[model samples]
Target: MPLTLPLAELEVGKHLYWQLGNLKIHGQVFLSSWVVIGALLALVVVGTRKLERDPRGTQNLLEFVWDYIRDLSREQIGEKAYRDWMPFIGTLFLFIFVSNWGGALVPWKLIHLPSGELGAPTADINTTIALALLVSLAYFYAGLSRKGLRYFEYYVEPTPIMLPFKIVEDFTKPLSLSFRLFGNILADELVVAVLAFLVPLIVPLPAMFLGLFTSAIQALIFATLAAYYIGEAVHEEHH
Candidate 1:
């Protein structure tokens, strides 16, 4: 008997895996990812080419987004260090935001792949895990770079009783981030796929809209948490 994943074969990028050397790559995931990234780059180029004083069209939208990101980072990471990390946090938020909306709106599944279907990159567990690991690394870098050897003092702050829990938290943080994102995205795709497959018209519309809202929320939540983690690492209590 052949094994099968429940409700995954017909929806999103879960049909099969592409083997590339030692790595198990999903062709659809990368395909959509590159497409979305390319579009974003093109927008950046077009938006910056003119640079008018009033900031019209794409420039205005870009500036608005930039300011929002800046404010969010500042609120979470504090004034001193937020400027340095804003770009990273902004990129993470934008990528996830676009990817999620793309999955819900773009008919990527219409573009047939040799193995799997194209969905949001975040819908892939591997992509989410990679992103979560990057956040983990970013916080570690933030802590070590700002505090040097003193960063270790975080684990025992207040008292030594938090040492074990703090150590466990390091492992759990990445796991939580990855699974939460992957699960939410996959579930969104799943519901939309099932509705479209079954009703194929008006039934899926509501689900699709809900998916977009949830997608944005997920991106915001992920970015906020990431900035908070970095902020915590870099914050000094000043005793």
Candidate 2:
């Protein structure tokens, strides 16, 4: 007799491919991402459509979320610079938070694909790396734009001896950021799938709950770090 594994085992590393002219892309990631984006936009639209002195329903929720993201940015990026970058930071947080939770909670497996099934966009290495690279670009742009040529002086701040490490940090920042999010999300999904495969019922519930919690935390951490990086770049040095 041959042993067979159940579908509950889950496909860990597969992607739905779409050909766009000559370039191939992950279809499922985009599909799920679009869903998340649409949901976020709809929420924003509905929430802001009617603004009142006394917030109600979705408006109240929206205001609370806005305040939370604002505070996070203000605390990390400072009052002067935080306002300029709050939208970017908030978008990152909301997008990642939705992607992570949606991937975990939604029954994506119900919607089958030719190759890969739908999951969190963040679970994909390409998506996380792209986001990480964007953050890297943002900080560099922020520094140079705000400080002009003086931004290069950051490499030597505290002491010229720090130049080598600062240069290396530029490379490490994105690498660390991308891998951290990617690894955590991938691990969480895999853990839940494996537990489901083994027990097929009640056992996976706890892991699923924990995954949701971690998902939210990861979003917050990513946003906070992004804001902090920008703040550090634009921070003034006093004589």
Candidate 3:
């Protein structure tokens, strides 16, 4: 009998082939991050198309998520800023929460595709980096919109001596955000793989449950920090 590895351990480079040309796309393109993002956007659009004052079914579920995210924003960023940032914050939370859970629940190993496995979009580093960039840009735009030219003044605030450290701090936010998510999800996936490999029967069950908890916590942490960054960007300094 050959050694069988879990889907989590499978590498795309070995299972999928890519053509090298100006217009050539990889065989795994369908399973790529863009496809997942498109699917998420489509769901959001379809769910919102037939809105009702009294929501039901998918609409109710969407509304529930929205309310949860709104509450999170209000608590973390305050009411005045929460309304303005709700859509961005809400979208981030929904996308991450869905992606994390979906990845764990989906039977990527059972499906045979060009890609090695059909894991969640959030499992990809590119996807996480893109999300972090969006968060960084959101805060940048919020800061600019709120403070105009004064946004630049934030760096030199308290004292000119703190300028260099403040500048570095600003630059590190996105990097930290991107890596924190990527590292946690990757580790979770790896643990799942190792456990499944060593004991295929029932040993991996506990780890799966733990992974779900960790995934939710990571998503919440990411969204909370994002809200905090946006709040910091737009907050007025006390004299």
* 136-160 per-residue lDDT for model 1 (tens digits): 9999999999999999999999899
Q: State the local distance difference test value for candidate 1.
A: 0.90
Cα deviation at 224, candidate 3, in Å, is 1.1
Q: Ten consecutive residues with minimal summed lDDT in candidate 1?
A: 6-15
Task: For residue 117, give model 1's deviation from the true position in Å.
Answer: 0.5
| lDDT score of residue 35 within candidate 3 | 55
Off by over 4 Å in 2: 1-9
On the 0 to 100 scale, the lDDT of residue 48 in model 2 is: 96
The Cα local distance difference test for each model comes to: 0.90, 0.91, 0.78
Q: How many pairs of residues in model 3 come into backbone collision?
A: 0
TM-score of 3: 0.83
**What lDDT tens digits, residue by residue, belong to model 3 across residues 1-239?**
37764553557334355566765444443364555567678877878999999887778877887888988888877767789998888778777776777777766677777555666667767677888999989988988998898987888888899899988987798889888887887778778877887888789999999989988998898999999989888887777
Comparison by TM-score, 1 against 3, better one: 1
Models 1 onward score TM values of: 0.93, 0.96, 0.83
Q: Candidate 3, residue 36: CA error in Å?
A: 4.4
Q: lDDT at 129 for candidate 2?
A: 94
Clash pairs of candidate 3? none
